[model samples]
Target: MEDNYSLYEIAVCELIRRLSNKDDCKRYHEVLGYQHRLNHYIIKCRTHGEPKEFETQFNEIISQLNRVSLLELNVSFNDICNNVSREKQDDVVKQIPFIIVAMTQSEAAKLFENYNESEKLKLLIDSISKGRKTTHFIRQLIERYAETRNKWKPFEKDSRTISDIINDLLPKLIKILFPIREEEANIDLIPDYYESAFFSSNLEERSEIRDYFIQRDCIFIVDTISLFNPEIRDRFLQSQLAATKPIIGILPISKDSMAACEIIEESIKDKFEWVYERYQRKLEYNCSLEAYSLPSFNRWLYKILPDIVKRIPQAAPENINKMKENLKYNSKGFQKVVLSMGGAK
Candidate 1:
């Protein structure tokens, strides 16, 4: 497998996926082209043929990514893995995305494991944020989990907001662990829905929700007001300050919202620098992962180019680069490599 695809092709593709948006991938698509090149260099590594589904998938994902803020697509860290994984799983070389090689094997394992478990995604994310190695099978497990997760379900309309994502998961955590509850446990005459109440944008309509929390003597939910609209950011803070007579403990910010626009613009610039930094952390993460995958492809190509050079390299320098570029860069490289090898086989 190393002889066929080369780490260069793998890594480059991973990086391109990170940088490319709908308007133009430019260098991003180049990585996919390199994947096809790898096939020509090594007989076994060549693709069987182009895949129709991949074209559709790439177009759809890239188009959506272009429309939204690039910052939001920080989740593209797993794009290369997700694309490859969507194919089939049983057959694997390292059975890990090239990025996995960047992490220690144990760290890789934890990443993959957490990635698979719904409960562990937050924990895994926290670990990654802290720069901790949370697993050993990161690479292999990424391949398995990426494919498993990519079995596309329709997008839920409610999932458009950051709050929606948290709401979907938070309730499950509440049910099983019961980690957070009121200090003085009391069965309320009316249910406590303070979390939802405070975020209401309509000032006139928020009276009921504000009264609900005050009635419960809840001082703050820790950064809860950070989720409010920009127009109301200050208003919410002022109201909360006035309403809570005695200053209490800190409010907890939702982990997901930490990277949100509201939080980023309003965040303590020094403490959470990544939130405000010019570089997109997600894109950087993807690039780092791809950097790790490159050497493997280089190692593979080092072995195979001798044979192919006679026909291809001898033909034209432009052809060589184009072939290599396509194999290693383009989305079709996935199928291109297989077909390239199948023709040789």
Candidate 2:
């Protein structure tokens, strides 16, 4: 049986060789344009005689051309690898902020575990105020916490009220965190709102104050007078417009302060709208007065003091304390009210 199988394989191999040779001959004749001319010459030679000289010369020329074209195209493997690496790096850079933002609450907790709550809060606030690319992610984390749990409350000191802690630490913290630069716009506190005679004086007398307001990038109105009186509100709005400076009004609220609050709200809306139209730009005007009662205001102060510190990078303890003293003196015996504008919401 083995011998018979071997004989069959030999016969099939011989048959395949014959068929392959026949196909190759047919293909060689048909494939090349020069094959037709060669075939015609071959037929002529069969009928007449061989052209030895021309055939030898053509063969030699084809051999020389083949030898000349032997060099393969060069490729730089290193260059290709380097280009791919550069593209990958750029993609990673773009994704970094998003990756940070997408971290789970547990992941964020672990990332910040080394720092105390105050330190973590400070870092977050700093990251936000510096307009770091990572700010959006940080904000997302905060919002997520707010949604799932309550807002992340800061660690309180045992001896001091949150307000007192803020008053003591905020100014120094801001100065340390964000140093003043010559190119940066000034951040000024309107320490005593009553001392600003711009509202009572004519436009001419307020030129210096107007110019001062114009040059600043941010102004903190610490007093409550500007919010209630229409004329003072108009002047404040005008100053902001002249320089495109942002004003943060902090008003202490009380039972009798409703009218003032209404006036302030209207003034804010009017000014914001006017600015939007004049500049052909949209602006956001947010007031949280509705959400704040006296007790709630104290809590709000605790929650927002970090943000306020971030915004007013130039806040100094001396300036803040001076404002507080002036406020105390001017108020006589009214309950402390809190109103703030323009910071993280």
Candidate 3:
């Protein structure tokens, strides 16, 4: 029999050969095939019998493939080596981090492309929370994720609690994350765009929105109406998130229009709705989401709108002023959402 090499070993050989011949670059389909092969190869190498030979060969091939130093990949590889025991029952824990760090943003994304329900949370949590006991790290991960993908959520008028969380916690985290003077990086965590119009509100537009959220590793919180009458909005949110698995945090409204702000507190209560919490204690603030009045949120949102609008083509000069106005008006409605919660506690 042809040296019973696991699929990964064979794949490593094929990809290395392809890279050497530089053929994968020429064949577009091969690019896709290469990724599948790479994933399967990693899985096989990790779980199959005594992989020292495979690892050695894989390392040799990778050495040859190395054209540039990938800090993320190197760091991740080191992390894997420390965590896993290849000699044991395929304890491939270490490989997970390496695969995460090694792949280009696009390649890393493919790992989740075929994820089943149980597997999705692992990806989201590892990337954001890192299974650490620090809310600071988790929050920064969310913000950095937002910034990297150009998704910035301007604090809504009703997101007084969220605004407080952002303003109070964000600066402190930035200080820790960017310790050196040169390490400072401007990050935006809000969505690139937001349409209050739910799923039934638009089809093509909703799909685009879903894709946007998925790419950014984000979640959505539908307005209060969804909480009261969830049939349509819930379906809309689900349909939108079908392509991309973002947490959908639903905020319940009081329907008084004036008491709409209550949704902010309720939304935090429903934070698990955004991302499932197998262990609820792991959440920030004990998942006790605080409340920040709408004015507080709008102040920050309006401050950032000018700069944000400048980059959006759809937001023309005429529309810029209009958006600013809309933000102010929205802030009022949002404020109502927050203030309504005042009676609760």
Q: Would you estimate the TM-scores of all the predictions?
A: 0.19, 0.27, 0.26
- For candidate 3, write residues 1-345 as lDDT tens digits: 134544334444444444443554554454455445555656666678546755665565466456535575466454443222121122100000000001122322332332224232333334333346444543432332122111222233233333233334333433443343322222211222243322334667656755655543322322322222234335443643422332223222222323334433344346324433411344432122221334333343334333322332222334434444533424212111110111111
For model 2, what is the alpha-carbon lDDT of residue 22? 39
Per-residue error (Å), model 3, residue 12: 44
Which candidate do you rate higher for lDDT, 1 or 2? 2
Question: RMSD to the native, candidate 3?
Answer: 23.1
Clash count for each candidate, listed in order shown:
52, 5, 20
Model 1 lowest lDDT segment of ten: 92-101
Cα deviation at 135, candidate 2, in Å, is 47
RMSD of each: 29.2, 28.3, 23.1
Q: On TM-score, who's better, 1 or 2? A: 2
Instruction: Give a tens-digit lDDT track for model 1, residues 142-243.
Output: 332221111111121221222222223323322232233332111111111233334445666567655644543332222221222232344345355323
TM-score computed on alpha carbons, candidate 2 = 0.27
Per-residue lDDT tens digits for candidate 2, residues 198-306, read 4435676566655654543322322222232334345655555322433233332333445545554454456555543433344322223232233443344344443
Tell me the spans in candidate 1 whose CA falls farther than 4 Å from its real position. Answer: 1-164, 167-204, 217-230, 241-345
